[model samples]
Target: MDIQRYLQHIHFAGTPKANLHTLEQLHRCHMLAVPFENLSIIYHQGIHLTPAALFSKIVEHNRGGFCYELNRIFALLLQQIGFQVSFISGEIRARDGTFGPPFDHMALVVTLDQPYLVDVGFGDAFLTPLKIITSEQQPQASGTFHLEHDGDYYSLERRNGDRCSHAKTLYRFTLQPRQPEEFNGMCHYHCTSPQSHFTQKLVCSRPTENGRITLSESKLIITQDRQRKESTLHSHEERLAVLRHYFNIELNVQAA
Candidate 1:
């Protein structure tokens, strides 16, 4: 893996020491730089999970990807920078209090002083890495997050007081280390299955200093300082402009 290129892609200038501070800085930078997008599925372009292909698409072409592409390649980059990283599978919790299949999402566990759950793929979730313990609410720019342990599994929850009466469950995961090849079946399923949300939408989102900007299909939503401004694009050209202006992606899908 090209460590220097990956660091340059994330626009990180901090030290690469395998410590808490470096991990926090790198995690935050990656979140702000690359986006969480699934435009490949929308365009009918098959996504590749290999490190080389992901590096070329993200770093060279300045595009973002879903969890399978984002977290897997991120693990490679972190490993190159001397951080002990492991790829873990997460099952996303639906709104009806049910969980998706295993390997529905991809996350990382970096072993520093303690284990940290690092993810740049879960769109508008935690900006920095979350500690792998069930104690202490992890504060983020978005909101306070918590992890609840249930026997052998861990549930990731976000506090949603105003929008909902209870804490919202984001996903459930386990500490079991996984190989990249293990996710290939679900990765293909996500892109090909009609029930998969990725195959159903064109979403490109990234976090800003104050909030986040998401371009889903023709709608452009910008949330800054707790205020949201929504707009609709009337033409493909406008959508392409938004992709280049906001997310820094230049793709051939404008004509699709």
Candidate 2:
């Protein structure tokens, strides 16, 4: 992979190092720059898990992807920058209070001074890495997060409010290192399955300096400092224009 090209793709100009500062900067840069999008699924396209294809689609074409595509390439970028990274699997917590299947999501267990959970794939997530080795509430630009260990599995949760009673489980994962290939089946499932949310709508979102902006199908929502503005696009042209304006994505609906 071309490390310099990937760095440019994320618009990251900071020094790359195997330290917290670099990790945090890279994490925030990637999250804010590359959106968490599922446009390919909307176009009935298969999501490729290969590193070469990921780099081509994300870095070359200047597009974003879901968990597998984003985390895989991000892990490689970290490794190239001399940070120890392990590809790990995460099971998303469903609304019904049940965890999804194994490898439902892809993330990284980056071994820095202490292990940290790093993910640019999960939409509407924290802007910085979370300390997975601790139970202490870690404050972030987005919200406070913490890890809860239940035997072999670790649950990563974010606080919905200032108190602990509102902790919401984002996803559950184990520290076991996994190969990128292990997620192939579930990745395919996410893109094609009728039950999958990615297949249900067109979504592209990214974090802003104050809050975030998300576009789902024709609805556009922009939030800044807890205040939000919502709008709807009545035409395809308007929707595409919103994508280009906010996420820097130019989509040819027919070509996608």
Candidate 3:
């Protein structure tokens, strides 16, 4: 799986032998190093959901990717590291209050004695894993996150600025293990379809201790304290510069 290459590229210093603590550490480390981005799709490049393709895109090319690509490969790595990882399809709820179909996004539900909603995909949701128990309050670097029971399902919420609001569920997880190649069709649709957000804008994001930094087209957006800072990007070079300097992404000059 070229696991060592990934760990070294991401600068994940932890040992390969897996355990709960190691998983926790990898969760945070991956978020910091590999960004959650969708720039390839925006630049008219094809997106593949295979382990090789994803590893090349992320670890080798030093690029970032969306949920399907990032989480799919992350899930694979977790499996290779001897963790129980399952791939589940998430329905993205946009800022405009619209919901998409299942497989609109992808995330991992990891089981290690206790389960954790492990996602390296969502740009800036929870930096750490969230306990899957319905009654547990999972503390995060950003804030306290809770997952409440809703009959057979679960609802995720986050405490931000003294207000607790609904956070989108990545997926309803099962113990089923999935391979990254299984999601190829869905990934292709997201990268190519006009209805897909990836095709609409060039976006790349990486989590920070405070919030997250997102680059959309020629704009750079940083959020902290629930407040957003945005600035226009005059040219593609400026956009590429922001991505390379800030996110550690090095893409082909013409790609941006």
TM-scores, one per candidate:
0.96, 0.96, 0.87
> Model 3 TM-score?
0.87
Q: Superposing every Cα of model 3 onto the true structure, what RMSD results?
A: 2.7
lDDT tens readout by residue for model 1, 1-256: 7788789889899569878888888889899999999888888878987778999889898889999998988888788778999989999998788999999999999998889999988998998899988868776778878899998899998884443446888999999999989999999999999999888888999999999999998999999998999999999899999999998788777455
Query: Higher TM-score: candidate 1 or 3?
Result: 1
Ten contiguous residues with the weakest lDDT in model 3: 168-177
lDDT scores for all predictions?
0.88, 0.89, 0.74
lDDT of 3 at 108: 84
List runs of model 1 lying over 4 Å from the truth. Answer: 160-165, 254-256
RMSD to native for every prediction?
A: 1.6, 1.5, 2.7
- Cα deviation in Å at residue 193, candidate 1? 0.7
**Can you write out model 2's per-residue Cα lDDT over 86-158, one digit (the tens) per residue?**
9898999999999999999999989877888999999988889988865588878688888889999999888
